[model samples]
Target: MFQQFSLTHVQFMLTGLGWTIGLAMIALIGGSIAGSAIALMRVSVNPVISRLAQFYIFVVQGTPLLVTLFIAYFGATYLGISVQPIVAIAVAFSFYAAAFLGDIWRGAIQSVPKGQREGAHALGLGRADTLIHIIVPQAVRIAIPPTVGFFVQLIKNTSLASVVGIVELTRTAQIVSNATFKPLEVYMTAAAFYFLVCFPLTLVSRGLEKRLKS
Candidate 1:
């Protein structure tokens, strides 16, 4: 029997929305760690190291996000290790986000003018010092917009956690819709919630891009 969409249903969805945000934050922080390492290795002068990084990024980025999730969940089960939904989702999204973020940041770092490096070399700064004080700062400015834009996608991708039994936004909406028999209302509400979370990021990213350009 279909029940009415009640206030409680809305509240439940709100709780799930919180989970979605939390998952995205996890992905961001963890991915940033993994991504920095990947970016550094990708740009390493060592051909072997660079090739390895390239392979890692290619394999991970080429895989479907859902397949990553499945590996985090079911793959762990096959290995006889239990995995919680949040942990699995975090691990999956972290590696997934790392590939793209690393690629984005690598491009940003390389996009810096070669003259900047020449000037740093002329100043007697070591490679590490040049990167820390000069190259990184400039690359960071270039990277901010794309990084934030990727965050928007990360937030949306949290919906995939539903398949793993995480009560994130999409899963919560599905539950509510099933009970109330109101898929349209529940899904629209979910879409509104996602827009509320993501639209501000788009604005901020665009603003930063213009500021950087100027």
Candidate 2:
């Protein structure tokens, strides 16, 4: 018997949507912390540190995210280490997000005018002081649009957590579709939930870009 897609189903999916938000938050926070370090290392004066950071970014960017997730989730078990689904997801997403975010931030940092660094040097500002006080503030404006855009992409990418047995929004949609046998309705609702979450961020990104420009 086909079950009607009802309020109860919507509520169940809402619970899943909450988990989706939670996962995205985890990925973003972890990614940002690691990415900041990667960005700094990429711009390091030391050739060795910069090259190592470059290699890390290259490898992560070249590998597919799905493969990374599988390695994080299943590889742990193979190593006789037990881990929760969320833990593995967090690690994998952070690692994957760091590569791109690092590159995005590197470009932002480098985009600051060369004359600004020269001016800082003329004032006897140390490299660290110049970066912290002069360069970073300007780089932040350049970074915001692309960072927020990547965040929106990250939120949608959380759907991949389903492959690791995460009961996030997409997984809930799958369950609901199976039970009600209404994939179109169930999936359409899931897409709406994603749009509702992501669309606001898009508007915020644009607003910030305009405000920063002005």
Candidate 3:
């Protein structure tokens, strides 16, 4: 039995889209902070600190985002700890984003010309000032395209948060589909919304890349 899709259904889906954006923002902010630390630590003079950051990146990047969310949401039962599903989803996605962002940025930072770094030190700037003043500004431009790309990925991955009961876009579509028995229409509509959100970012990423090239 199928019911016709209505304007209300469209509005319902729109609300879900809001949640998707919110989740993506959470992932972006949390991931950036953690990623910055990891990237800096990876370049540390101390071998031990560098190795530990490397290990963190390896394990995180190696694991699937869904599995990480599962552990964050469900693994807590093993220790009798309980957390809200949204909290778990946010934490998982953030850490997942962090690993990839860290790698992206580490490459960007290392890509800065060696002479530039030496020049900073030669001017009597300490390592920290050299990096903050000279290194990161250059690295950030290199980082933008990839960072935007990862944010797009993060937006799509928020669908997984629905599995943990976070009522985001995909979850909303599932509900709408069930109510109207029009899974195809509802899902296609959901896909359209996703494209709507992501296509602009893709264009922006391209524009930024071109700008950087010039």
Q: Per-residue error at 78 for model 2, in Å?
A: 1.7
Candidate 1 clashing pairs, residues 3+ apart or interchain = none
**Model 2: how far residue 91 lies from native, Å:** 0.7
Candidate 2 per-residue lDDT, tens place, 1-214, comes to 8799999999999999999999888888888999999999999999999999999999999998999999999998999999897998899999998999999999999999999999999999999999999999999999998899999999899999998899999999999999999999999999999999999999999988899889
**How many pairs of residues collide in each model?**
0, 0, 0
Question: Could you tell me the TM-score of candidate 2?
Answer: 0.97
For model 2, the local distance difference test gives 0.94
What TM-score would every model get versus the actual structure?
0.98, 0.97, 0.96
Q: Record all residue pairs in model 3 with backbone atoms less than 3 Å apart, i.e. clashing.
A: none
lDDT (Cα, tens digit) per residue for candidate 1, span 1-214: 9889988999999999999999999999999999999999888889999899899999998899999998888888899988776787799999999999999999999999999999999999999998889999999999999999999999999999999899999999999999999999999999999999999999999999999989
Residue 198, candidate 2: C-alpha displacement in angstroms? 0.7
Between candidates 1 and 3, which one is better according to lDDT? 1
